[model samples]
Target: MIGAVIGDVTGSSYEFDNNTEDYDLDLFREGTTFTDDTVCTIAVADAILHHKSYESALLEWCGRYPGRGYGGRFQMWLTSAVHRPYGSYGNGSAMRVSPVGWAFEDLEITLAEAERTALPTHNHPEGIKGAQVVAEAIYRLWRGEWDKIQELLISSYGVDYERQLPGVGVFDETCQGCVPLSLLILTKSTDFEDSIRSAIHYGGDSDTLAAIVGSMAEAYFGVPDTLAERALSYLPQDMREIYEEFRDRFIPTSSLEV
Candidate 1:
C-alpha cells in the first residue's frame, strides 16, 4: 500500500511533464504530494478493513480531500447526490484497486473484491478488468508466483510484450491503455524503483501508471525503508492511521514494514 502511495507522490510532479530522458529522475520533487490515487487506495483499504461499502468510503474520503487532482467525471460524481456508477473505463479503477490485492488471500475473492471496488464508479467491462488485472498481479506477486506472471499476462490478457510502448507525453486515461503498459513495465523492471522509473519513462498518466506498477513491485521486490518512510510523511495523520491499521492487519510483518 505504501508502495502505491510512494509511486503516486513521486510521479505526481511528472504527471504533466514526464521525464522521458531521465531514468535516474529524482524520486520526489518540490511540492510533490499524494493525489486521488492515494486517497482512493486508502478508501478501498478502509472499506475492506471496516466492512463498509466502497461507495460510502470513497464518498467520505473524496469529500475530505477535494481538489487532489481527481478526474473531472469523478469530481462531478463526488459532489453529486446521485451515487450510481457512470460507466467509466478510466485507469482510475486500476490506480485505486491496489489495496484489494493485499486484503484478500484467495485469487477468486481478490478478483471479486476488485470488481466491487470498480463497480461503484468505473462499471465498464474494461474498467472492471483493469482493476482485476492489477489486483491479481499484486496477489500473485505477494504469493511469490512472479515467475508465472508473464505467462498469465500473455495467455489470458494477450499483452504483446514485444510491442513498443506509447510515445512520451501521450496521456491515455482509459484502462485499456494504462493497465497493459503497467503490466509490461512490471515484467521488464529490475526492482521496485526501476518499475516506477519505467512507468515515468513511458509518460502519460504518470502517477496512475506508477501507482499500479508500484503495487505489484512492492509485492515482488519489497519497498525500501527510505522510500516507505518518505511516502508516509506525505499522508495526513488520519490517512496514515488507516494505512498503519491496514498494513498491520493485512500485510505480513516479515514481508514489508514502514
Candidate 2:
C-alpha cells in the first residue's frame, strides 16, 4: 500500500505535463501529489481493516478527496446518492487492488476480494480480471514465487511482454492496455524504484501504471527505508496515519517498516 502511494506521488507530476522515455527522471518534483490512486488504495486498506463494504469505503474516500482527479464516470458515482456501478473496464480497478492482495491469507479469498473490490464501480469483466490479475501477482510476489510470475500472467491474461512497448508518449486507460505494460515493466525492473521508473517511461497514465507496478515490486523487492520515508512526506497526516495502521495490521513485521 505504501508502495502504491509512493508510485502515485512519484509519477503524479508526469501524468500530464511530460511524456518521455527518460528513466533517469527525478522521482518527485514540485508538482507531485497524491492522486485518486493513493486515496482508493487507502480506502481499500481501510475496508479490509474494518471488514466494511468496499463500496462504502470507496465512496467515503472519494467524497472526502473530491479533487484527486478520478475518472469521469467514477467521479459521478462518488457524488451520486445511489452509488451503483457503471460497468467500467478501466485501470482504476487494478490501480487500487494491492491491499486486497495483502489482506487475505489464501489465494481464493484474495481473488474473491479483488473482484468484490472492483464490482462497486468497475463491474465489467475486464475490469474485474485486471484487479484479480494484479492482486494475484502481488500474492505470488509475497509468496516468493518470482520464477512463476511471468508464466502465470501470460497463461492467465495473455499478456505478451515480448511485444515492443508503444512510443514513449503513448497513453491508454483500458485495463488491457495498461496492466500488461505495468507487469512487463515489473518483470524487467531491478528494484522497486526501477520498476516505477520503467513504468513511467512508457508514459501512459503514468501514475496508475507506476502504482500497479510499485505494488507488485514492493512485494518482491521490499521498499528502501529512505525511499519510503520520502514518499510518506508527500502524503497528508490522515493518509499517513491510515498507511501506518494498515502496514501494522497487514504487512509482515520483517518485510518493511513504515
Candidate 3:
C-alpha cells in the first residue's frame, strides 16, 4: 500500500543514522527505493491473489522474499518448509499489515484476516495483537468509525497514548518499541507528509515505524495525490509497475463496491 511504500522511501536514508533530534533534509527527497515494506507487501499480495486465505498470504510473503531484511526470528520462519507459527512477536508483521484493512469489506473481516495472516508466522500473542489492532483501526476508518479508532487502537495495543510518542525511543524496535510508537506518530500526524515524518523523526527502526504510521495514515487520511505520486517515483521501474498494479488491485475501489 501507499502507506508502507512511502514509509520505505522516506525512512530508507535514515535507518543507520540514529539521531532523533536531527531530521534529515533529503531523507524523503526523491528516488528512494522500496525495502522490506514494498517487497513484503508484494509477496502478501501474491498470496492473497493466489489463495483466498490470509494465512496463505503470510506464508507466501515469507517465502517470496527471504532476504527481505526480515528480523532474525522471522527469517527462521521464512526458511522452514514444515513450519508452525514459530511465535515471533516482531514488528515485521505490523510493518506489513496495512492491506488487511483495505482488502476486506468490514471490521470483523479485517480483524479476522489480519489475525489469520499474522498468526501463521507471528502467532505470538503480541504479534497477532499488533496486527489485529492496526487492522481494526483501518477498518474503523474505512467504515467511518472515527470515534472508535483512538479507543480501539489504545485498548488493543495496550497503550494509553494520550499523545503520540514525545520523542525517539532507544529500546530495541520490537513490538514494544514499534507498535505504540507508530500509533503515536499516526495519532499526532495531520497528513501524509507529517505522518511519515513523525514516524521517521523517532529514529530507531525508522523504516518500520514509518511504514506502520504511513499505512494508518493512508487508511484514515486516504493518502494525498502528491505524496502517493512521489512515493512511487522511488521504486525500481519494474517494481513501480508491480506496486501500481497491486495498489490498483487491492486499494482505491473496495471489493464491495460496484
Instruction: Output the number of the lDDT-best candidate.
Output: 1
lDDT of 2 by residue, 1-258 (tens): 777988898989999855465679988878888999999999999888888899999988888888998999998888887879999999999999999878889999999999999999999998999999999999889889898788866876665544534446677787877777787888889988788888877786889988999999998888888878998998888888889898988887655842
lDDT of 1 by residue, 67-87 (tens): 999999999999997987999
Q: Lowest lDDT 10-mer window, candidate 2? A: 159-168
Clash pairs of candidate 3?
164-184
lDDT of 3 by residue, 1-258 (tens): 677788877887677676657544465644356677677766555555556565565556556545655677666666677767787777877777777777777677778888876777778888888887777776666566767866775676556554433345453455655777777667777766787877777777777788888877777677666677777776657556656666777676542122
Candidates arranged by TM-score, highest first:
1, 2, 3
TM-score of predicted structure 1: 0.95
Counted clashes in each candidate structure: 0, 0, 1
How accurate locally is residue 170 in candidate 2, as Cα lDDT from 0 to 100? 74
- Kindly report which residue stretches of model 3 are placed more than 4 angstroms away from their true locations once superposed: 29-31, 52-66, 159-171, 236-242, 253-258
Candidate 3 lDDT score at position 173: 54
Q: Determine the backbone clash count of candidate 3.
A: 1
C-alpha RMSD of candidate 2: 1.8
Model 2 residue 7 CA deviation (Å) reads 0.7
Question: Which runs of model 2 end up more than 4 angstroms from their true locations?
Answer: 159-167
